[model samples]
Target: MRILVLGATGYLGGHVAERLRALPEATLLYGGRSPGADLPVDLATARPGPLAEALAALAPDAVVNCAGAVGGDAVALAEVNARGPAVLCAALRQAAPGARLVHLGSAAEYGPGRPGTRVGEDAPTRPAAPYGATKLAGTVAVTASGLDAVVLRVGNPVGPGAPVAGLPGSVARALRDAGPGPDAVLRVGDLSPYRDFVDVRDLARAAALAATRPGPLPAVLNISAGRAVEVRELVRGLVRASGFAGRVEETAGGSTRSAAVGWQCSDVSAARAALGWAPLHTLADSVAALWASVAGAPVPAR
Candidate 1:
């Protein structure tokens, strides 16, 4: 099987590509604007006509799109998160309609979920910001595209190789910089929001399953831990894993999504039923691994 993975150099995409490459009879191809990529494709600016020509040549059996902008201006987000998927779908329809297109969407697309309720895929998408709105646009493009496709709406991804742009990596960096100084105070924004955190490795495994599974699949599936945890817990876990003795003070200014969405969790039952997928790592495990990656040292076993 020939598989083309877009954004294969990104945090999530890299892991997905690694997992897919392990398949016994699979030929994994990287598709991106990166010079080293096998297929030089940039979804953000790619047009269907030219992209169709490229796709025709590659003739991939499956295309997993992990390209997206997590934090950017409206125009940038729309370009990558919204226009990118639409263009990819258009090109696929013209050249590789039979190829399965697995898109990585964001849990932010669901907006703020009810405090204790697990939001299902069927829940209405009411994005609180451009990031979620743009991601929802991408999700719509894939689900509405007349192709063998599935959208994996992922939650807060935490694990190794996590970039400092996200909360997990940001906290880890702060702790590492602070060292073991007891007087060091790590000031952060409000961390009272609840989030569904999933290990990046587990998410990659789900992507592999979705790409290789036979027959038709649901248009969308929630990929999450199925449990809403306080954001402070994740922060504290990193601190413990990093052995940081500093104080983490909750100050003003942080992620807008956290402030807007007080609670967010997903119903992952559909994923288990459809793809036999369930997260294997606990939040603690993810935290430990993240700290290990950032600190370059083994964490205390829990």
Candidate 2:
């Protein structure tokens, strides 16, 4: 089987590519605007001609689109997140009619779930921000293309080697540098939101299953840990895992925090029924790995 992974150099896309490459009897092709990619195809700005030609020639069995605008203005987000899939699907429909397109989606598309409920795949998409809105548009286009496609709406992945921005990353930073003192306070965004945090390795395994498993995948699957873990608790957990002794302070971190899903959690029954997927890493396990990565030491599992 031949697979093409877009944005393979990025965090999530890089993991997906690594998993695909490790699979037996799989020919993996990676493409993006990055010069280090195996195939340099720019889906952000290029026309369909290049993609169409490449698809026709390669005839990949699957195309996974992991390229997206996580943070940008309305126009940039819509262009790269919404219209990118539209253009790529058009080319795939014409050139590689049999290819299965797996588009990476965001839990943000479901917006804030009902107060304390785990949102299913059938939940109405009420995107509260431009990122979610644009990503939802992309999913709609891919599913409507009359081709075999699936959208994996993943939760926020926390593990080693992630971008140093989110809760766990921030904690890793504090644990590594800040001494255990009264002045050692780590300021974070509003810690009131509830999030489902899956380890990136587990998410990579799910992506591999979606690409290579032998069953029909659901049109949409929520690949998540299925638990609404509060941000405050997560920060504390990371600190404990890292063996850090400090204080955490939550500020009024604006209303625009990207992954803040006030009460949104995921119902993973569909993902399990479709892909037989499950997370292997605990919060502590992920935290240890992340702390080790950031601290440049072997943070033994405590």
Candidate 3:
């Protein structure tokens, strides 16, 4: 199988592309703003000119869209997160109708779920944030286009290659910079909201599995670990794993954005039953691995 990974330079997209390259039965092609060794076409603005050309030239069997913009101006988010995937889906259908298009959706689409209620694939989608609303729109557009598509609603993916600003990465940075003073304070957001987290490697494997499966595509599948961990618990776990003795001070002004306050997680049974996919790393293990990367320790097990 030949696969094309959009946003090949991103955290999750890069991992998916590397996994596809490692597959003996698969050949990987990358499409993005800047062309490296692979193809390059701006999905956000291109009018299917270069994309259609590349699609015809490569004729890939699958396309994984991991491209997205987070927390930007509303117009930019709509263009990149909503209109971008819609355009890509239309172009892919026209250029390569048989290619399976797997869209990387987000857990944020569910917004803030009620406490103790597990958000499943069929759960009500009440996206409060601009990013989540745009992503949900993109998912709708992809499925409505009558193309072979699967929307993987994923949670926070923690693993190597993650940016230093994300949740897990932020914790790792805190651990690495531990000291005695106000500088050592872990400036964090609302520590009360709970979230389901998944390892990026596991997510990559799940994407590969989804690509290889044949039949009508599921509208949406929740890709996450079955358990929810509170933000404070996650921070404590990282602190313990890294042996950081610094005090954790929660300031009134230090909290997540308005869109990220409520408890949210997924019931991943759909993906597990259909794709045999489950998170393979424990939260402790994930934190340890991330800490190792920051602290220059030995690589942990995948």
Q: Pick the candidate with the highest lDDT.
A: 1
The local distance difference test score of each candidate is: 0.92, 0.81, 0.80
Off by over 4 Å in 3: 180-183, 253-260
Among residues 3 or more apart in sequence or in different chains, the pairs in candidate 1 whose N, CA or C atoms overlap within 3 Å are none
User: Which candidate model has the greater lDDT, 1 or 3?
Assistant: 1
lDDT of 2 by residue, 68-176 (tens): 8776688998889898999898989889887888899988899877777898999899988888899999999888988788999988788877766455776678667
Each candidate: RMSD = 1.6, 2.2, 2.0
TM-score of 1: 0.97
Q: Which ten residues in a row have the lowest lDDT in candidate 1?
A: 293-302
TM-score of 3: 0.93
Query: Using alpha carbons, what is the TM-score of model 2?
Result: 0.93
Q: Can you rank all candidates by TM-score, best first?
A: 1, 3, 2
Tell me the TM-score of each prediction against the true structure.
Answer: 0.97, 0.93, 0.93
Say what the RMSD of model 2 is: 2.2
Where model 2 places Cα greater than 4 Å from the true spot, the runs are 180-182, 254-260, 298-302
The local lDDT score (0 to 100) that residue 208 gets in candidate 2 is 84
